[model samples]
Target: MSAFDGVKVAVLLFVAAIAQVSIFGQLHVFGAVPDILLVTLVAISLLRGSVAGAVGGFFAGLIVDTASLGTLGLTSLVLTLSGFWIGRYGETTGRDRAHAPYLSIAVVTVLYELGLLVVHFVLGESAPAGAVVRSLLPAVVLNLIVTGPVYGLVRRLLRAMERQELSAEVQLLG
Candidate 1:
């Protein structure tokens, strides 16, 4: 990716992180807040590759951790893994799939919540498995609901870079 592309992604994630903590974080529906940052990260990962996803995940997660004054590096770890795996999926079997975004969002939402629970347990914090399980369906639903528009916007924003990346992948294959 070009320097400009990197800057654009950074700015995008920065805005996403800020909005996530400030706005979406406050709005609760069905006792669950929509994870806009996670959806945005997934969209970027689906367009970019593992490295970009990992970096973007870390950047966004750090912003979230800082903004919320929560445990440092907690979100970073989970989101980094989530982004990398999603990016790999995009690079491999999910690139052209119509349901990639929806599938990724649904699966990652579950995994992200489970990951947080596990981490909290390990750290002797309040795990609250019951609450997480109760909220899982709603969170996944909310994320999937936003996936179409978020993915479209992200894909549109990164269209040039995505084309370049796809051409490079094709050339590599041939």
Candidate 2:
């Protein structure tokens, strides 16, 4: 990965984390919250690939774990696996803007909840079906709803970064 890409990813992680914790929590529907980090990971996976997805998920999850009542590394592990699978799928399947990200995010929100369930179970925590249904369902819906616009932003940022890279390359070759 280019150093620029790394920097971009870092900035994304930072913003995503802050947005998740600060802004997203402020807006509530059905007593639910939007998971910007989750959406970000899915978008990154669809737009880039599994490796980038994994890194994004890892950082996002780690931040969540530290920021909330949940156990440490739970989100990290879940998000990392989610990102890996998402990225791997992206690599095998051609990305189409019309529906790929929406489809991926739709499915992934469920997978993310599933991963959380498994982690909670492994940790000997009680499995509350209502947690996902009552709380996370709305969160998932909100994430899917926001995915399109957020994905566009990520795309725009990537294109800008790509232009910078291209300019740098041309200057080097001059």
Candidate 3:
């Protein structure tokens, strides 16, 4: 990507961070907080790549770490891995199927929670299994529900950009 793409990504990440911190977390849907950053990281990874995903995860995690007052790299590490996995998912699987994003988010959501639980354990903070389950399951379901629309919007932007690039390439060739 050129500087333009890089800047776009950074702006989106910043917006996502701000939204996650100021907007999403505070919005209680019957006491269920939206995992806006996590979902954004997931979308970024799928739309971008593993490196982008990892970077997004790292920064997002740093924000969470700072906000929550937990260990510095806990969220950074977990979200980085999640982004990496999603990027890998994008590479390994073709995106022709309509069901892919929803399914992928559903599976990745559980794994992300488990990874966070492990991080908490390593950090010497013990959470009851029930608490972990409670926090994770709802977040996963909500993410799955939200993934479809988000993916559609992201994919459309990507496709439009690709078309522009393709047109430029054709013109150069001619």
Error of 1 at 108 (Å): 0.2
Provide the TM-score for each candidate, comma-separated: 0.93, 0.84, 0.84
TM-score of model number 3: 0.84
Better of 1 and 2 by lDDT: 1
* Candidate 1 TM-score, C-alpha based: 0.93
For model 2, the stretches where C-alpha displacement exceeds 4 angstroms are 135-137, 163-174
Model 2, C-alpha of 3: deviation from truth (Å): 1.1
1-174 in candidate 3: lDDT tens per residue? 445665666666667777877788777654356676777777777777788888878988887778767789988888889888888887678345566677778887888888888878777788566766777767777777777776766666556665777899999999
Q: After superposition, how far is residue 75 of candidate 1 from its true place, in Å?
A: 0.4
Write down the lDDT of every candidate, Cα atoms only.
0.93, 0.80, 0.74
Clashing pairs in 3: none
Candidate that beats the other on lDDT, 1 or 3, i.e. the better one: 1
- Write the residue-wise lDDT of candidate 1 on 16-64 in tens digits: 8999999999999997889999999999898887888999999899999
Instruction: Report the lDDT tens digits of candidate 2 across residue range 7-106.
Output: 7876887788778877886888886777788777777777678888888888888887787766878889989998888888777874654777777777
Candidate 2 local distance difference test against the native: 0.80
Please tell me which predicted candidate would have the highest lDDT against the true structure: 1
